[model samples]
Target chain A: MEHSGKPNKIRLSTNPTNEALSKLKIGDIVYLDGVVYTGREGVYMRAIEDGEPIPMDLPAESAANFHCSPAAVQNEDGSFNMGAVTATASFRFSKWIGAWFKMSGAKLILGKGGMSPEDYKKHFVPNGAIYLTTVGYGTGALLGRGVKQVRALHWRKELGLAQAIWVIEVENFGPFIVESDLEGNSLFERENAKIAENLSKAYEGTRPAVLKRFGETDDRKDELI
Target chain B: MISIDLIQQTAETLMDKAAIEIPDDYLDGLKKTASQEDGDLSSFVLQAMLENYQAAKEDRRAMCGDTGCPRWYVKMGNEAQIEGGAIALEAALRRATANATNGVPLRPNRVHPLWRTDHDNNVGIGAPEIEYGFEPGGDWVDLITVHKGGLFGTDYRMLFPSDGIEGIKRFYLDCLVAFGKRGLACQPAIIGIGLGGSKDTCMVLGKRAACLRVVGDKNPDPKIAALEDEFKELGNSIGMGAMGFVGKSMVIDCNIEVGYCHTGGMQMSVHAFCLSSRRAVARVFGDGRVEYRTDPDWFTDYQRRDTVEWNIPENQTKSA
Candidate 1:
């Protein structure tokens, strides 16, 4: 078990080097300093499935692909009003993740919940990427404060504001924990194993439902994702 | 009659307040839970959340980017009237929702479920659901906005009475363990359990049990309240915390609400109001006075009355 004291905190550029990336381990806290862009199903669908031309430079501009739909709007004068930027759950985007890494050269994927261990091994490990899950899952105001400027916003007309690609310059821009490391280690999975040890005690004397769903797994260890 | 303009104005302010401020009851509960949490990663996450709340208030930004699907829980007295009737009141709320979706810059989360269309404003067909409740007397209306996160941590099942309390406990543990794994439910949450009623009402009651009630409040029924206490302890005892870490802070509080169901079934539903349990309430009086508050105080004695007719007790009577 890790100690109760504060975990190690490191500040890395959004476009981090291999050495910096390699140093990250499960549960290490991270803050990014550079540019990161928002992209989820809409952006992924447009770029990968719809065969649209990519707008921004790949890793040269920003290596962080945030699975996010920020609370933001485009003003009538063509500017943006961006507030409370938080990450959506990344597990739902597993299908598009591998192609996203290959096309975008993204070294970092920031989101709410981390992806599966299989995803870390197949998509993340091969593409030199790691997952940083936003702390509290709702720390949007704290993360929003890190935005120094809204550098660019694309596809507002095509994809709508929520799903649009929002490029922002940031400093001290996170309280994200490294959910996955370069070697495909997963913090959530490890914690789940530890928590699973006590499930029987908690479930003692409780009777299962008489009726059952079609494909429901009785195994508590089996995750929905 | 309460002013229509005041209703719109107050509703918009509520939209902002609900998104930005973490209610005091939930905050206090979380603080206590955080202090007790011992897991290294979980403790850190709790502390960060504490700081994040302060950041949200200080900066006047929405506490969460997802901002949730904004909904209204409106309760009025028998004599309460609006400047324009219920039709105008509905329009005002829809307008308030749209204006605030851009004004607070809340995520336009209410999209066309199938077409995936966006209005940029949160106003859409059957969007920003408005539910109504009524009290016995007085000339006031309460406008409560709850921007509840619309994903994971909610489920329902039909259980026969033969399954008993044991079945209830089993289902409750199942939900907490399943969604709690990835911290998808965003625990240490306020868990609401609806143990009876039809399927639709079961969902509604469970959701209200989660969203409308404040932390630490108990049901009037002694037995149900004891079960609530037991369920709360049971949830935290799952050995899970924030982000599904190895800790004991999975549940801040557990609430149970019930309704009479068919004799054959004990329909059950569980809903988890997430870390950002965003809710704000305001009471508008006929005399143009508006009072703002956090506690919805939703489940009054009348709301849960078991008798055929609601007979007002002398001390509890409201002014005409």
Candidate 2:
């Protein structure tokens, strides 16, 4: 097997400092320490849309906000069983992210597919936050191994298990790549630009469909998200 | 009669297996794809996935947090009979699905489309859909469960016969490039193409092609098989790989399933079975024998037969 050079790897605290956050670059591998929490559309709708007070301390308890719902359950005996944990697509959460950043004081956003560059430029840059995307998008077991303990779970009744807030203490909880750095640079967009140069070559012998969708782009460079 | 208890038990086991273990054929295909991958980031992603599979098996946890939508495909022999008939068999499968959702701790991915009501057990009205098929003979029942990630990497388009092969290639590329950016479709996937069926059946055939068939398996028709090979190569040549990085591992395999359609409409749908590619299968017999396997073995000659009447093969009839 051809072994390409590995990307630079670092271990950072979930509650990171300005100096610590500044050192990150796009495509660098990252492993997180300390505490992180799961929050997505459910949390967004309630905490932001419905104007519900956040149940925990902002960024103090956990600065890393993960767009995830673990394979987990709340036992009748008042305990939690969390197995594999992985991220969902972050793009869908873009609408409420700016408000989320201000309200939560979140410094790190972790998820599956990274958000658009416009999001990074607007919300992430102003808030001194960066984005780390989970590797393979299915490395749930590996990420699960990083959990030291389930600290707490919130909103079980109101939001249900999948949308409930899961506060977790983690050790080396990652295999996340730096998708966005402090300067608002996006690794995915960078890679997409490079890949676009060769797309025409790939689409060499193909022809467009007879019937077209209402709002479809023929440009290979255009991205759905 | 096939015992309902066995059906439920086997189904629960299949759900656990589908969530935790990587099927062998897919693993091998990925290993080969990994070896050939040149993009550093994409290579790392593939390697991490390989390790993740091992971690899941060793720890008995799900490979992905979004454990997809769990669904069933049950194939029975002509002589096979369930203890409480088809309805009872369906209830057992639903029970198995709910029990395993908590037991395996699978994410409750199913929900009411508008109300978004979650049962928190991966089961509700029409949830964990159970599809069926039947063979000509024997008293054995095959149970297959697939947990495929529901979002992204799938699309449908209606094309005329005049649009031809080039049109198919174009739409395929469109789905790939659109979802491929930022790794939405989760490339390095098993790409299933369904052509010629009406809209709904086109989606079904494509999904079956991707989820039911094993890696390296091809269509029985040589011409279709050839197209599968060509499409696989064509997909990998798109200058993308795992996570949409610059590489050549976008497709682990490409499978095409076709059905008769209106003479003018060449309906097409594309489905992607992601890196996790979760599926598991087992067979239960009237003799109380049970066996587990990875391949679904779904598209038999009889299943794909075009004629109205099925003539039992001479060799098989003589042996019987």
DockQ for all candidate structures vs. native? 0.80, 0.68
What class would a CAPRI assessor give candidate 1's docking?
Answer: high
Local accuracy of candidate 1 as per-residue lDDT tens digits, B1-320: 89999999999999999999999999999999999998999899899899989999998999988899999999999889998899999999999999999998899998899988989888898988999999998899999999999488999999999999999999999999999987899888999999788999999999999999999999999999999999999999988999899888889999999999999999999999999999999999999999999999999998999999989998876543
Clashing pairs in 2: none
User: All candidates' lDDT scores?
Assistant: 0.92, 0.92
TM-score of each prediction: 0.99, 0.98
Give the alpha carbon lDDT tens digit for every residue of A1-225 in model 2: 224478889999999999999999889999999999999999999999999999999789989999998999989998888899989999999899999999999999999989989999999999999999999888999999999989999998899888999999999998999999999999898889889988999898888888887987887788884
Output the TM-score of candidate 2: 0.98
> Considering only N, C-alpha and C atoms within 3 Å, which residue pairs clash in candidate 1?
none
The TM-score obtained by chain A of candidate 1 when compared with the true chain A = 0.97
Q: What is the interface RMSD of candidate 2, in Å?
A: 2.3
Task: Name model 1 segments beyond 4 Å from true.
Answer: B318-320
Provide the lDDT at B54 for model 1.
95
